[model samples]
Target: MKTIAAVMAASAFLAACGSDEADDETTTPDATDETSEETSDDSTDESTGDTIDYPDLSGETIDVASDWSGAEQANFEAVLDYFEEQTGASVTYQSLGNNVATALGTQIEGGGAPDIALVPQPGLVDQLVDSGDIVPVTENVVAQVDANYAETWRDLSTYDGELYGVWFKAANKSTMWYNVGVYDDAGAEIPETWDDFMSTLQLVSDSGVPGLVVGADVGWPLTDWFENVYLRTAGADMYDQLAAHEIPWTDESVVEALEILGDLWGDETLVLPGGAQRSFPDSVTAAFTDPPEAGTVFEGDFVAGNIADQTDAVVGEDANFYPFPSINGSEPAVMGAGNVAIAFNDDEATMALMEYLASPDAANIWIELGGFTSPNQNADTSLYPDEVSLAIAEQLTSAETFRFDMSDLTPSAFGGTEGAGMWSILIDFYQNTDDVEGTAQALEDAAVAAYGE
Candidate 1:
């Protein structure tokens, strides 16, 4: 797929802030007559609009709650520092550090909510929406974002037709990360159909290397597989229905996808049984640490960062990616993962920063730091500066259809329920292939119980 390139240039200076004592300011937006409709950039000016000028905020601290760990977290802090220098709005980051959803919920309940929170998971966004604790980007704000990012991200970040968050660093998960050397040795081409894909796997296995490695221990990874299969097997509409809680799990299309996965699980030549014990973080090890072990892994682009320390396999050079093949020439399924900005204050300066952050400038900053695909349409992909990341960014830009993580978009509870159900399905298929129908029924029953439909 051809991607629209991002216009990358040297970082430009933004306006500065001038305040010091800014503290816990968690007042909801005045719910009086809030009007939200998609507006173009012409209607919303970055130079002059309803945005407030940079306030004099030198030491004034705004709490930013997050769950970023390792290099990603460090990079995030650097970005925050950029914002701080420009706005003079010093950030006292309250690292949620781990278990973001739980920690943020605790702070919200305890009445010590941060002014800015980083919601990395969609389930948390759903919860915040349900609680009315989140505020949408004001009309002026949405216009600013719309001018910068692709409309698709705005649609995804918006809940119930209201823009609630600013999206950043999105990576398309409908990708298959493969071992190039292994493929070269096996003399294989990337598959484009289910039969072709199966044949490739068989060919790889025939060469005595595991054809694939998937991590199910994290639960969400399993959802990734399910979403990819659902999109390929049942098509996008059905996948959306499943996402919106409008489709029953027992739907024949869903069952057929599950059955195919079951068959794959039964094929011992396909993947190592060790994959069942690996989590998302451990998937890199299980899949592509070295040859003679595992060959390919189905995961998101972020997996690149995880394996960087283990292998010198650069993105486009040593490693390559392809979208998960469709079952029967259906359109591809694209999944996204990233953080959304949720605000707790409505001050003019705060709102201005929020609006600006949603603009093309912020997108540039994100891409420069090797941030994932920005939903920002104005963002120049070259900011990624790396060939491989740039390729992934282009993949995101050209994607015809996109959805958030399968588990995170679903009700929080179902991630555990349906995820465990799928695991059982895999185990069942491994033990007794004839039990596919029974396991499918079990999954449907479990889904019905989870959603009460």
Candidate 2:
């Protein structure tokens, strides 16, 4: 199969989908179609022995909200069209862009929230629930979620033991992309362990080629590095604690994570020049252009789209990836993000569409459409556009555990806060890797203040 270049057209639509968690034990009853006979939900979703029971809501319409536009919006519009065809509900989508959080908040404040919303982060779901919003989902939707996705996903969408949303799309962040020609010239195999990866880095540096390119211009990539290191050293539980502000950023685990990072990045010469200033897309473009400046870029799957859409590099031939190496004796822990669909006001029509989305049947539709990865376990994997996508799906599913982006989990104030929170602190850390302790303490002070502890 050809690489996913064509399919990954509108990449970066869900850049922040990684940060956020839901609605009800709804016990809402399933409604049968008017025909009272099962039919395939959509062309791509059809299977030999399976059928979908779509509810009939001929004249009812519901408003959907998201931050998608351009190609991303088109992809979703296609899915929404398919949904309308299946259920006969007129669903209108509103692209709220980056201000979805604010836009939806304003709507709720004015008692005009959309019937459903595709929340980029689980934190938005929490914000809605905490404000006494009582959106509900049918039990069937919950069952579909449990049967089709991993427990971790269910947890991400759950609020205080009740489920709230459906994981519709995801970006696996536990991979690093490199130039195959560069690797071939260096005579290096993709590293499978932390030690081996480090040695490979040294070899690249020895070859006079930079070892890695971190898109630290925005500070989030630095946060990704910490998350990967912490997941490897301290495992997932500690990762959770740090995200929830239950543990100070100066905790021993945080230090260990920072140390591990320092070991990998302390040598400024190993990184591409101007990484602190270059945008993520700029870094990717550099790697694919002639006489690449760096050997590899550590980023999520979305980087594939950036490469394909922006450069002439052939994915899998010129641009490719390997799972980020295991570290500190921990197994593979995937760090990533996804889009979650939540209801603003549950109704027969809203609950019906949600239940449909929760199922593997609905997920497979998007999977076959390309540029979409479903966490749904039962979704047929054979339909992925290419080996690149299929392999990513496999690695993501087979991971020992999956954690949302760490910075995305922390309050925006602490994680993305400009000049004061993790963002500025990590930028400083990048500039001066020797002051690991001071950096860790700075993070702690920032977290304490942000969390109001």
Candidate 3:
């Protein structure tokens, strides 16, 4: 079976992120000599005969675009460098950071899409496909993906039955990150059920420490909070229906979710002071904040880096996490997000990059660097630098199932920062979780209007 380029250099490139963040500075690092290894990037493939075709794309320059910066961008550059060395092609990366989608859309609409793009949304992939602008997935890339990833992941990058991209990087937002030291000092066991988790929070508070920190500086944290509780309480079918707007936000289950979250948010004693104004980074630092403002911070795995960059807590030993406890029986569902690698340019050099990115070869470059997660099951777990990385990988892979960000799936108008979206609406709810029904009705109104439009 064919895998991504086996550019056997004496050393693999370092493109992964650290607590230092992914650097956006583009690098066209020189490639290393190509040597053959008997191993394929996808270890699951039964056949590893020498029949794989590795194309030589020397002298061709391909441009890639993504919203990733800090360690993510650097990790990508390392992969590009390996691909460059194997195929002798020059590659440049553009880290659009937070403004990536708009910039990519502008470029695509203006007839200047990059050779390859890592899109964060399935809807965007569909949008590009519907517009007839994306370079359709070729058979070669499909072979690598089918061998490397699960059907769900493959479906995520697909439009209809046809594949449009590869899900490269992923984040597990189903976690509640906290300071291991604080949690241990309390001598509390990890709660397995939602009710018990709340009890645990109250226990922490009773111990003269704030139990939880809710940061709205980046409003999506609340959105994630709602998603977690909603899925756990209402079931996946209902969650999907709500996400698709098939059911109104005023649905009873939706109200229940908000109320459940309110158990934490509404409690003045349990939650940190001034949660509305605490930025995401501030929340990351809050537990480790000098004198310690809070004990637990819930968010995605990315917060590990923010914690490292802002504080000196060592992961696993000092900084650690637990899966959000389940409300219903069975495993609480995992709500997460990932990037789908898509191409707009049909040129050979461009398709090659897509093939390389989807392979374990590229993913491993970052996997080894830490502060990153790979859903590509074929990517070796041993490559992870620490216990924290291995544990997160387990959370991501062992999940009964995974979902991309719900907001990213909806219209940017309601789910996004536009008028009356989850961002603003959730913020309002955080400020006043008092009127559960009123807040739920407000969300439905916005959803109706946004979906109506």
> Which candidate should be chosen as best, given TM-score against the real structure?
3
- Per-residue C-alpha lDDT of model 2 across residues 402-447, encoded as one tens digit per residue: 7777775665567644455777888888878888999999999988
Candidate 1, 257-317: lDDT as tens digits = 7778777766888876755566665666655566536667888777666556446566666
> Candidate 2: misplaced stretches above 4 Å?
1-63, 66-74, 84-114, 143-147, 150-152, 205-209, 347-349, 369-371, 416-420
Ranking by TM-score: 3, 2, 1
Cand. 2 Cα-lDDT: 0.70
State residue 435's C-alpha deviation in candidate 2, in Å: 3.4
lDDT of each: 0.61, 0.70, 0.70
TM-score, one value per model: 0.77, 0.77, 0.82
In the range 1-453, model 3's lDDT, one tens digit per residue, is 101111101001111211121222111122223212433332222221112244777779998898777656766787787777677789999986544456787787798778888876555666677777886678878888876676656655665567888888888788888776667778766888988888887877777778898888547789989988887888766776777787888989999999988778989988988878887778878887766778888988777767666787877778888898899674646787767788876688888778777666677677766677876656655666688877776776566645557776766566645224787888888988888998888898888886774
